[model samples]
Target chain A: MTAADHAGWEVVIGLEVHAQLATTSKIFSGASTAYGAEPNTQACLVDLGYPGVLPVLNREVVQMATLFGLAVNASVARRSVFARKNYFYPDLPKGYQISQLELPIVEHGEMLISDADGNDKRIGITRAHLEEDAGKSIHEGLDDSSGIDLNRAGTPLLEIVSEPDLRSAKEAVAYLRKIHTIVRYLGISDGNMQEGSFRCDANVSVRPRGQQELGTRAEIKNLNSFRFIEKAINYEVERQIDLLQDGGTVVQETRLYDSDKDQTRSMRSKEEANDYRYFPDPDLLPVEISDEYVEAARATLPELPEAKLQRFVAEHGLKKDDAVILTASRALADYFEAVAGAVDATAQVAANWVIGDLSAVLNRDGKDIGDSNISPAALAGLVNRIHDNTISGKIAKQIFEAMWDGEGSADEIIEAKGLKQITDSSAIEAVIDKVIADYPEQVAEYRAGKDKLIGFFVGKVMQETKGQANPGQVNQILKAKL
Target chain B: MSLDKVKVQHIAMLARLKLADEEYASSVEKLSRIVDFVDQLSQADTSDVRPMAHPLDAAQRLRPDAVTETVERDRYQQNAAAVSDGLYLVPKVIE
Candidate 1:
């Protein structure tokens, strides 16, 4: 529950996400756009804004913006103009940043996000415009001097703005994750938050529950992670509610979320808001995209996250939650489909193993599905063994661990360790007889109306066979004997 | 829309420029004239006119996505006033 529940206020949130486009060079300059490069190495004369240099548009950036617009079902403007937003900062060598103002590339798009109740909530995408990124300023360990790295300068970015439609922090995260999945599916960005490839700024406000007008908003900037976004919005919402309860008005300003302190503080007041002196950039011309261009780009779009999730449920007959988790990432979804096709396992069983054990191991090791050591074929082999009763699910887990440790394939490990299930009726009968003899007192108790003691006999049978006996057969034989 | 000495000083501060006291008056006058000239365009009725962002009617020209330039850290950093460890050093920025 949110603080709004008690305070009788509702939280409203919108997100502005800046995703660095996946391009080999800077947007305007012929400079390498590779991350982690030596400082200033990628800064060309145009990037540095030399006196006589002008910007030429990067074609891939426009295509990427169009592709995102198509993915989100947005209207791709046929003509978009670039404007110069004037500001002065050390990191920005140019006095102004080239961005979209009056005319953006994409507008009026909507995305469907699954809320906490598993209901689809549509979030309005206000606009996604193209812009250039600023460089970095490092202020650590400098002895009153700051280091400037222009490597990120001139990098192409798509600033996707959202309408203030989210009611809670969880919804905001869901929206963010949906966008992250879409971008990754499009292969337009690495979507690495830590590496600053995808960055977020949240506009948060709170008002009385029945109030129609929105309260003043505070924009929390540079939220790089999903956890931070949720935490920061929650904190900001609480801060606003408390202030309003005490008859204080929420201040409209820019705040920075200090992750270490778990709080937000004022970065700049409205008075410090830059005029920006926005005007059309004279150097670069307006971008014109044709219908055919958009159609071609649309044809190349991969199956989006929502469609994939629906298909995973419809075709695979998987649980909705399981399908959502399996289709969270494209690679994991592909892995599941491959394993399901290779083995004779039911969709339910396949989903359980993949979402249960495989995800747990991946999470524990801090690895992505793409980095898994267990190949899809090997996992399918293991599942096939379980299907054929060569091993029970419990015993297969041990084989899975051995496989993860590079012991061998599932079949090879089972053969080497002699861990196959004892499904033969005669062999299981022998184990059950010994178990009944050893548990004679419990058996007498069971026959004298202690039906619960059957579990004790089953345990003994399992221990006698070292958990290799088929549990179903053991239960059947034990019930008959009793 | 109007320029004055105080507003000029604030602009200079935002731009990170230092102007002598004697130069403020002249700078304010020059900027005011430019603004006044641009303000004249507002007098003409533009309700039916479409807004234009660029003088040229050409669309944006796009280049193929490829790394066409090599790293030139030393040469690029040579343009900075001060540099150390492949970074451009400036006066400490608090935030």
Candidate 2:
């Protein structure tokens, strides 16, 4: 069958992002929230559901939730309710998790995502509320007994829901990236994927664009990487399209993305709302957020990534692509700004070096800019050396390579290696004279009006000086002798 | 909402549960009650109200472009029932 008409088929994508709140202890208990702790040692009586235990809402968790709401420009509910979600698993010693059901702390908001073309798309935020996490189930060896890890139990999780506003896998990834940036900028979560600090569950559905009837949607769970998010959604969309083309109806259910196979497989029949038997949690009291609290959180929010990206373009004279690359992460953006401020001689040059050479090295080495041996000041020092002609561009590249190897400062490396550019016309002229005397055939070729011999002469001079001679001086000396 | 015996058996198998006949009879009755209570939720006039997927209204968090961990394959596979050449082994049903 021909691909579903764009005018007819519409892809509705909603994301449920789970961010582990940056807290030292569990949400309702004093259990350590540290990752990679010995399996059950982190568990406490409260986390293990001992009788007579009560869940005291962590104040820091509330503040973190409020910070996220303020960052998203969402409304903070004056009062919210926590409810128990009932389910059975070996990892869930409590038999139920304390989650917000009826009333959530944060309400509706919108996130503006800019596409590659600089067009802004607004993704709708439904709610962001706090909940305690369930422990993990490790199904490793025994067929009859699965290992249980309670380290994650009672961990504070802020589950953010989005409206089905994303239309493509790329948009879904962009939305995830924007959310990731905002949360990290707000300092609410560490957002580490490998540690399961931040995870995504995507709800994907394909429907006729103008059709009132909605197609069944599949929820793809536990995708942590942006690449996987895009690939999983794209694959799911194709699978749904193929099923419909083969005269099959899409089934609504939860599925797991097999990253190795690059496919989504049905996990189980999707649970409806009533399955959980959700009711107001009696052990906890209703959370009351004051106007002052919301206002304070709003005031404490730092400038968001999108705002910083815009400022980078408007104020720093950076290209949109360069701005996007620099502001992709707060660390990278801060590093760029530090270097840019140091070398105000040219902002574009600074951006180019960071986004081009620096990014290339980091990507090639599989290291983040923060992990590079070249610090912001050191990078700025190298750029300044180039600008002041203390080193040629080629020499600067060589120095940068050494700097990345954890060698001492740019100046030290230049001095130790004797890589400083020789800009003196006399020095260049002497080398050029030796080259003209040695290559008489090239000299005659130049005298016979073969202008290309000039290039040969310049190359000879640069070779004689071990790439330390200035290209401009060599060009001037060669042209003068010819 | 009635949990037929076949449906009960199917759910149990899907869950990888091996149940006795006596347990199956009791579970069917108990599960029917639970399902009936859940079916009542369908009666709510949620036509206008949007179904909420999560309680919170926040976005995803991103990590720095750095490697934070390394999974030592041999050590990780130590817990597996069977492993070979950096791979986990499972019973082959295809053959």
Candidate 3:
């Protein structure tokens, strides 16, 4: 809910995001961690929790987690233990899910998010711990029984828990987006919400504005998209507020958001609220990370979003807003840098064309920057034509459309279409002379101090030359002649 | 430490065990005695000692990130009592 809807109450929200680590195999087994496969094909004996099988930690998982911790400036625990959280579910072939309880890998991490007020706010990360994901249960297409697919069992996940610091659904989304950007920048996770690689569960509560204690919190789970996360948290906040105002107390339980109905309904809570007796796993010893390991991971950390944004502004001389937009994705930022670096024009021109026109076409075609039809070099070529006045900026749009349609380079398009700007002083002066003769009334109005009619004369000159005349030269000539 | 019949019944339910009504009394007695026996260790004053999870004083060994397992779904499913399309079927647990 919006902060204004709180109605003399304070909204306390914390988010727990589970990101699937980009690993080649399961955390404790050698089984493949590929997303789609035949049912139960990827699950190994250790993944299935077979008897007498012991788990060995994956080095890459720990290294990836360490990289994330370093990226967020969190402390990498010298030693962390894996524990068993006992529960019973059909998908869990093992009676317990191995998770971290007291000692997690990373803690006290914070990230800056532009709050609802669009100011820098640092949200504290309570902890990020390593855990194994559970298998999937397919209830559909079965007449009376649910089928279990263990293919996703024992996948490595880093569950990041945030402090109860959020005040609005919008702020919560900002925090989530910041985390997504960080993980993708770190290259530890793909951050693909569609494949359940990154998912969020929001713990939302509200209390009187001046109250020190928190209200009973309801945990909303399985929100995959940013839109659903915002809507679900807002819906939950409104529900809790309405309940408390009606003299009903809020209950602490897990909720699933019904996107179709745009409402949240309580799932069975008794079994979930039952005690999960956590005990350290006896089979595996405590994991101990070395300072050398952390240092090595730190060295591999590429320039993160903040550093990239600053570099784009300082080195490329782009505006802060454009830098932020380009730095949202690593590939997009790289694309911008490539264009900016290769163009004969100012980087700001590259930024404008990339952010304004190129992004519009990409969004309309439902294509990612990676799948763009126009390569960065080709785009730079197009920008170069406008920069050197080989083509007017207006004609550049036409050249860009041709380039997107695979009509060769800008020079080739200009040659084939005869779309060169009329930069020769004689040619432009001739067009301006013709336009002045054609639009005498506008010329008279312009000389009579209707200076805005200069646009009318300029348009006529552009029409006479088929939009090839240099706009600045035409403006100067028209103003002097009038 | 003591475990009552209700507590034992709750534990049975948590573990998904079907306990007969008469079995609760014996389970509580045995469980309480076991807890009491373990509780005797609490009498020692070792608050300064670090909690140990495993007996071995070794760190967890890490395996390299590599997929060595191949498709053994046919051999694995042979142990299942019922399966359709390589999935383990269980009674529907509708909420």
Candidate 4:
């Protein structure tokens, strides 16, 4: 059920996202941070915590964190502490994780997310702290044993926490997507959910519509996809509402979403909460950020998504929805800008084709904007042909298909397939005359005030010319002749 | 801040330690003492003092973003108690 379905209840959600930073080396070690290497290969002595080993803070992580802070208009703490959160699992070799506590790096930020009604809503950011990631535990391929891969043991991650301002699952997803776009635009993280670069944990609770006290919450962990995050939050909200309606109080716990079952199951309870015994790490020093460093990082920031979307609408004369789609990704926005620059006067038409046809093909093929085989200039050439009356939109689509199949450029495909529109006025008139003469009955009806018969004559003329006749010219000439 | 026997057992469980029944009492006492010592430091009035996270007030030293390490899968796996196909194998992990 949607949030609206529960009439008198408010579903409150807060998201804690762990975005892996795009760094070449591990956060505390000189080990390669490349994904999908052989197991245990990237774990250095420091990562493995061999006796007498120490962790040196990575400077790139701090810069990227500061860049993200500026992107969200957060305060970049001049002095932030790295504390050790003590926990134990096979994946964590050091028996504790180095993270920020007491004083985090970035705090008190806000991000704007659009609600389902397309109205902007601001969500408060609590804090964004840098931490080291745990290793991977492989449970497959072993009948009675599991394997540990420490390749990811010391990777750097920025844990961005959001306030409980999201009212529904849709709002939560919109907020998450906004964060995803920001990180990608900043070039700090690849934002690859499938590869575990970006992941979220949702804290969900429901209270009476006007209740001031918050209800008990359950944290659903490790949601990697947008679809799963939506479904899991919806399901969890429904579960809590049902329990409360049945006179049962909600229990605070940690849950894991089973995507296959489409339900959440309890992983652990609050009674099992780790003390964490957080304390400052003795080895690493405080991360001090100078005003000069903050300015430099801020200078490196790219034009964000909202500004780009507004520019696309204002400068390119695109509709709001069209601009939103065009600026969904930085690469796509760049591609649209290139096409618009090449096809100057008809930038709106270029926006239509890019957002409509190009997006449809990319979605169908499960490809990204960067994966398109059609270059920006090639699409510009096709749009220019349509604009200059060299080819009809229908034939342009065929040329696009051929271009997608690697046939050749738009000009080459149009020439080789003889698909150019017949702009010769006399030739089009000849086809229209023959079409009218061949259908005298329809023409007589057309003269009897049956203006709809003009459609029949146009279809016949188009068919006679093998769909290459200019449609606008055919309509004008067909009208004058009758 | 003092850790009870039950609290000590819970901590041990979270840490995945298989503490023996005879060890819980001594472990609780030792952990309680450590917690009390840390708690004593918090009793002083330091409202004017800033919470310090590191000993030295130095900025982090940065290295260039480059892959400078070589893979030594076999050599690294040599320290594992059990291994198969270059992976460190242990007891089965259920989810």
Per-prediction TM-score to the true structure, in the order listed: 0.95, 0.83, 0.96, 0.95
- Candidate achieving the largest lDDT: 3
Quote the positional error of residue A244 for candidate 2 in Å.
1.3
Error of 2 at A85 (Å): 1.1
TM-score of chain B of each: 0.79, 0.80, 0.92, 0.79
**Local distance difference test, per candidate?**
0.90, 0.81, 0.90, 0.89
How is the predicted docking of candidate 4 categorized under the CAPRI scheme?
A: medium
Point out where model 2 deviates above 4 Å.
Answer: A1-8, A115-118, A270-274, B1-95
Please provide, for model 1 over A170-280, each residue's C-alpha lDDT reduced to its tens digit, 9 standing for 90 to 100.
999999998998898898888999999999999999988899999899999999999999999988888888788888988788999999998999985546446888999
What is the per-residue lDDT of model 2 for residues A290-346, given as tens digits with 9 covering 90 to 100? 798788878888888878988999999899888988887889999999999998458
Could you give the candidate ranking by lDDT, starting with the highest? 3, 1, 4, 2
Global local distance difference test of model 4: 0.89
Pairs that collide in candidate 2 are A127-B56, A127-B57, A128-B56, A128-B57, A129-B56, A180-B60
Top-DockQ candidate index: 3
Model 3: residues >4 Å from true position, as ranges? A1-5, A437-450, A480-482
lDDT of 3 by residue, A359-398 (tens): 9898998999999889999999899988888998889998
Winner of 2 and 4 under TM-score:
4
Winner of 3 and 4 under lDDT: 3
Superposed Cα deviation of residue A442, candidate 1 (Å): 2.8
